[model samples]
Target: MQVHECVSFILLKDNQVLLEKRAQDKEYDPNLIAIPGGHMEHGETREQALFRELEEELDIVPTSYVYLCSLYHPTGELQLIHYYVITQWTGTIVSLEADEVAWHSLEANPLDIEADKVALAEYRRLSLSLIIL
Candidate 1:
């Protein structure tokens, strides 16, 4: 099976993380709350893909961020996701394909979210250390 590369951004503000409710029509994880991200395109670096995906999905450009870690999902197809913690960005977030976009507290239960539960757990565990002062 081919392993695909994807990128995700954890945009945090006021101790809360941003999440998007996937559109019901989405091929994967429809109507589930997840971090903003998408598959990486050919010839694009991880950062470039992150920027492009964020723009396409939310119309925002990250100004500052830090690489977090990568996680693998082996549901149907193998997927490797590169996660990042975005500290600063420019432009208002507009959910183009998602049904809704909102800021959720880190303490919010991740069980309700259908995608990347492990990554969420990891983020919560390392947020204090990963966050820039």
Candidate 2:
């Protein structure tokens, strides 16, 4: 099985969170809303992975972040995810690797964005994490 290591950040500011709508052409389910983060590369720590993903996907440099948790999933496909909280960021958001970017209110949506709900249970358990598959 292919092992995938990733990270997702709950980027919040003034009660709003940064949400991205995945492109329709994305290998993942279309338009799924996700937090800002992605896979870890070889020899990369969780912070390194988070930084890389943030710059690659959104071109934003985070000013501050904190490790929140980690999860290992055995969803018939093994995957590990490192979750974090991005409380600060620099450089205005100018990249749109996703189909769209929106500053969403925490109360506006139900916060269910994953296709494989069970695999993402860990995130739901964390009050600060936005769970996903």
Error of 2 at 18 (Å): 0.6
For 46-78, candidate 1 gives per-residue lDDT tens digits of 989999999999899999988878987664567
In terms of lDDT, model 1 sits at: 0.81
Evaluated with lDDT, which candidate comes out highest?
Answer: 1
Q: What is the C-alpha RMSD of each candidate to the true structure, in Å?
A: 2.0, 5.0
For model 1, the stretches where C-alpha displacement exceeds 4 angstroms are 110-115, 130-133
Taken over the whole model, the C-alpha lDDT of each candidate is 0.81, 0.67
Please write out the lDDT profile of model 2 over residues 6-95, one tens digit for every residue.
887777777677777777886644567766566789999878888888888888888887676666645445667677767789978854
What is model 1's C-alpha RMSD? 2.0
TM-score of 1: 0.88
Estimate TM-scores for all models: 0.88, 0.75
lDDT of 2: 0.67
